[model samples]
Target: SDGTSLEGNVVLPDGKEVDAGEVQEPISDEVYYIAPDKCTECMGFHEEPQCAAVCPVDCCVPDDDHVETEEALLAKQRFMHPE
Candidate 1:
């Protein structure tokens, strides 16, 4: 995982140009964002979500807009990464 290609665009929270979909670009002033379709929630990496577990303010709650099952999560992981 040391040199994995993003293969996707890293856009800003307000849809501004940040990384321009490549890692070689210098980071822009725009805040970056990860699309929900690309976010794994750390399912393949950990049992519990490290983000929610280590969040100081406990603001990493589940979103009602984007609900996914365990199977779906795994499938997504595989879909993005065919390795």
Candidate 2:
């Protein structure tokens, strides 16, 4: 595995740019929570979720409670990254 850290541009709902490391809420020292509004499931960026693929423990499964259609996921991705 590459030693590169997972980081990227993050935009809030109010159009504020935030540090990627600060995006996920900390549940504990070893656990973090990804907000649904901030997660696009890598729809427009990859064929599948990279998180799930790269997770050593295979803990990045889909959230059935917040299931979204493909179109909706793409739309969210486009909104977050207009470039």
Candidate 3:
């Protein structure tokens, strides 16, 4: 299968746009990194994390060491994606 690619700007709450590389370290040319502070585990958008659901290799598992409550996750989601 041909690998998929992701492209987007990392916009902050302050309205500044940043490069994806600024927020997440590049693991390699093919691998992507998720920024923990920007991740809400898809709390507000879906019942479960879509990343985990669609990951071809099942590498989007939760970080046990950085567990967060549902309320905290939702709050973060709202903060990042205000309507």
Candidate 4:
């Protein structure tokens, strides 16, 4: 493992910036929540989720509860890392 992960500020729905680590985690043992607001789902980096692509066991699966459209994903990408 590279021991590296994408680190950047995430824009909240209200336009506030929060550290990536500040995202809330799942409370249940059965639920692994990835912050939808923070997850661009590799929108800016690749066509697919990079973590899932590179996982040795492919354990990184999409969060069904956090379903987002492409437009939403792209908008998030721009919001979090404006150029």
Model 1 lDDT tens row, 1-83: 21333345544333554444454433455844334655677777788876777878777767688888887777666655557
Clashes of each: 0, 0, 0, 0
User: Model 2 residue 13 lDDT?
Assistant: 49
Per-residue error (Å), model 3, residue 8: 17
TM-score of 4: 0.60
- Cα lDDT tens digits for candidate 3, 1-83: 01112235655544667664444445577866665666778887898888888889988756687788888888777765656
Mind giving the per-residue lDDT tens digits that candidate 2 earns over 1-83? 01113256655544777665654445578774556775778887898877777889877766689888888888777766666
Q: Name every residue pair that clashes in candidate 4.
A: none
Ranked candidates (TM-score, high to low) = 2, 4, 3, 1
User: What TM-score does prediction 1 earn?
Assistant: 0.56
Worst 10 residues of 4 by lDDT: 1-10
What would you estimate as the lDDT of candidate 2?
Answer: 0.66
**Model 3 quality (TM-score):** 0.60
Task: Identify the superior model by lDDT, candidate 1 or candidate 2.
Answer: 2
lDDT of 4 by residue, 1-83 (tens): 01224356644765766676654446677845455656788887798887677778767876677788888888777766667
> Model 3: C-alpha RMSD to truth?
7.0
lDDT of 4 at 18: 61
- As for TM-score, the candidate ahead, 1 or 2, is 2
User: Any idea what lDDT model 1 has?
Assistant: 0.58
* Per-candidate alpha-carbon RMSD to the true structure: 6.9, 6.0, 7.0, 5.5
Off by over 4 Å in 2: 1-28
